[model samples]
Target: MNRFYDIINKIENNNNEITVSEYFHRCIAQAINENEKELVDWFCKIKNDVEGELVAWAEKHGQKYILGRNRAERKTWGIQVLLGKKIKYKDTVLNIYFPTEFHENSIIVEQCF
Candidate 1:
């Protein structure tokens, strides 16, 4: 089985005992602690793909945006910004950092590993 699926299954099976968030945190923390490159690389690729999708969406909608990485409070991750006048997408403003928590947590997790 793919390690990713294995991790998901493990999370699902124990969903009754812990919240999905907690399970995911534990899995990633363990993976990082053990220096699991395959899983880590998988996560990095997913992050990159997510950033790409966000950038593509911004461009498709005629928004001027920049994609790059930023470090704040000692956490680093890819970031995308919709520049110029404030643009509203549905109910929220688009001038916000993307994937703030996931990437930030991953940065914080790296230190524990």
Candidate 2:
């Protein structure tokens, strides 16, 4: 299986806070190294879609949290997706913190591996 898929599968299996972030960061790093342009573009698009979905969901549910400007910027051919939350990347793991407070959310990050 692709590395990204494997990471996502691991995240789904664990469903823990730290694990999710680690998996996401590792997957994003791999995606950045493998196909910089495509991953960057796709991340930019997906980030926007996710923000919109989160906003609509929050509005319907009367949530007070804000959906800030989520953007994916490229730096030296590396793609970084900046949400309101912060993500830390290491050699072996990627850490992500979910913005929602109610339920666990799953993100399907697709890219060529």
Candidate 3:
């Protein structure tokens, strides 16, 4: 099994809900095979505490909108939908929520879609 899958399995087996940060950390630790400190720093820089932001955005935007990154390269790490609501990209009126910003070398956002 791939390392990412392994971390998912472990989390599932634990039967305890974990934060998104925890999940990201576990996946990065297991899969990257690189400098741990660097990877962790990168992860911390880009990952957002999305739950609260999602809720607030949804409430304000009527729960129908797209959430994406402003940076072109980091687009994938941005979410396209939340709670089954399709995010509308390029819609100036629709509100969008992005993950935390990071310095250029600290993190790379993978496209989510």
Best by lDDT: 2
- What candidate 2 gets wrong by more than 4 Å, as runs, is 1-15, 18-27, 66-113
Across residues 9-58, which tens digit of lDDT does each residue of candidate 2 receive? 33232212222233335455656766755544544554565455546644
Candidate 3 off by > 4 Å: 1-26, 31-35, 49-53, 62-82, 85-113
Candidate order by decreasing TM-score:
2, 1, 3
In angstroms, the error of model 2 at 58 is 0.4
Write candidate 3's Cα lDDT for 1-113 as tens digits: 13223333433312222333444556566445545555455444444534345445556666443233221111233322223312333322212233334542322222222
Error of 2 at 60 (Å): 0.9
Candidate 1 residues lying further than 4 Å off, grouped into runs, are 9-30, 63-113
**TM-score on alpha carbons, each prediction:** 0.34, 0.38, 0.30
For model 1 the TM-score comes to: 0.34
Task: Write model 1 residue lDDT over 33-99, tens digit each, in one string.
Answer: 6587777665555445445554665566554442332111101232222232222312211222323
lDDT, model 3: 0.36
Clashing residue pairs in candidate 3 (N, C-alpha, C atoms within 3 angstroms):
65-87, 66-87, 66-88, 76-110, 76-111, 76-112, 77-110
RMSD of 2: 13.2
